[model samples]
Target: MMNRRKFLQGAGALGGLMIVKPSVAFSYAANSTVQYALLGCGKRGTSVATSFAKNTQARIVALGDIFPDQLAKGKQHFDEINASLGFPAIDDKMTFHGWEAY
Candidate 1:
C-alpha cells in the first residue's frame, strides 16, 4: 500500500528529475534527418561535411561554391554519400555556384 509518506517521497523524486531538464529538447520527427548546407564546398568543406554526415544524423541538402566545377564535384560527392546512407540525392535548386555564391 502506497501511504501518504511514500507518495510524498515518490513525488519529490519525480519533481527532482523534472527540475533536471534537457538544455534543449529538439522536436525532430522520427527517422528525420537534419538539413545541412555546405558553403565553399571545397576540399576542406567536403571533408568536414562528410565527417558530419558520417558521425551525425545530418544530411547535406545544399552546396554552394564560387567555382562551378567545384560545386559539381561537391554535389557528386554528397550525392554518393547520401545514396550510401539511403538518403535521396540533393535537389539541383539547392546547388549554388558563381562568384556571388556565399
Candidate 2:
C-alpha cells in the first residue's frame, strides 16, 4: 500500500540514523578491556599481534595456529610483550593448534 515516495523517504531517514556518529551513543572508557584472537601464527600474524599487544588497550586472549611450533612462538611473543605491560600472561588453555584450531 505504500507509495514510492513514502518508501524512499522512510529509507532515507533510516539511512541517516545509521550514519549518525557512534560517539553520540557510546564512549570508550580507559579501563575498558578488549580481548582479541589471532587465527594465524605465521610471520604476518605474529607481527600484527605484536603490534596490537604493544600499542593498544586490547589483550590477546586466544591464539590459533596449524603448527605447534608456530603457536608456541606466537604465544611467547605476546606473553613477553604483555608481561612488560603488566598484563596477565595468556593462559595455556586458550591456545589451540592443528587444523581444528581454525
Candidate 3:
C-alpha cells in the first residue's frame, strides 16, 4: 500500500490536473442552465427571487410558502417571467395546503 504522503501527493496531482479557473470553467459559448427553488416569497424573497429569474442562465423550478397568497404570488412572479421569455409557465405540480398537507 502507498504511504499517506504518497497517496495524498498522487491524489492532489490528479485533482490539480483538472483544476480550472471559474471564468474558464464557465465559458458561456455553450448554453448554461440554473435551477432554483423559493421557499418563501415575502419582501426579501421576492427581491432575491426577481433577481434570480432575471438572470439569463437561471430558472425558477419550485416555490413553497406557508401562506396561500404568498405561494400564489410567487407562482405569478415566475409565470410572467417565463411567459415573457417564451417558456412554459411552472404551475403547481405539487401543492401543499399546510403542515398537514405534507
Per-model tally of clashing residue pairs: 0, 0, 0
Cα lDDT tens digits, model 3, 1-102, are: 789999999999878756865456566443457777777767898888888778666887777778898878778888898788776787688444455433
lDDT comparison, 2 vs 3, better candidate: 2
Q: Which stretches of candidate 3 lie over 4 Å from their true place?
A: 1-31, 94-97, 100-102
TM-score for each of the candidates:
0.72, 0.68, 0.61
Tens digit per residue, CA lDDT, model 2, 1-102: 999999999999989867676554355454477899999989998888888878888888889999999989988888888889988878999999988997
lDDT of 2 at 62: 87
Q: After superposing candidate 1, which stretches have Cα over 4 Å from the reference?
A: 1-32
Worst ten in a row by lDDT for model 1: 21-30
Model-by-model lDDT, in order?
Answer: 0.88, 0.86, 0.74
Clashes of 2: 0
Per-residue lDDT of 63 in model 2: 91
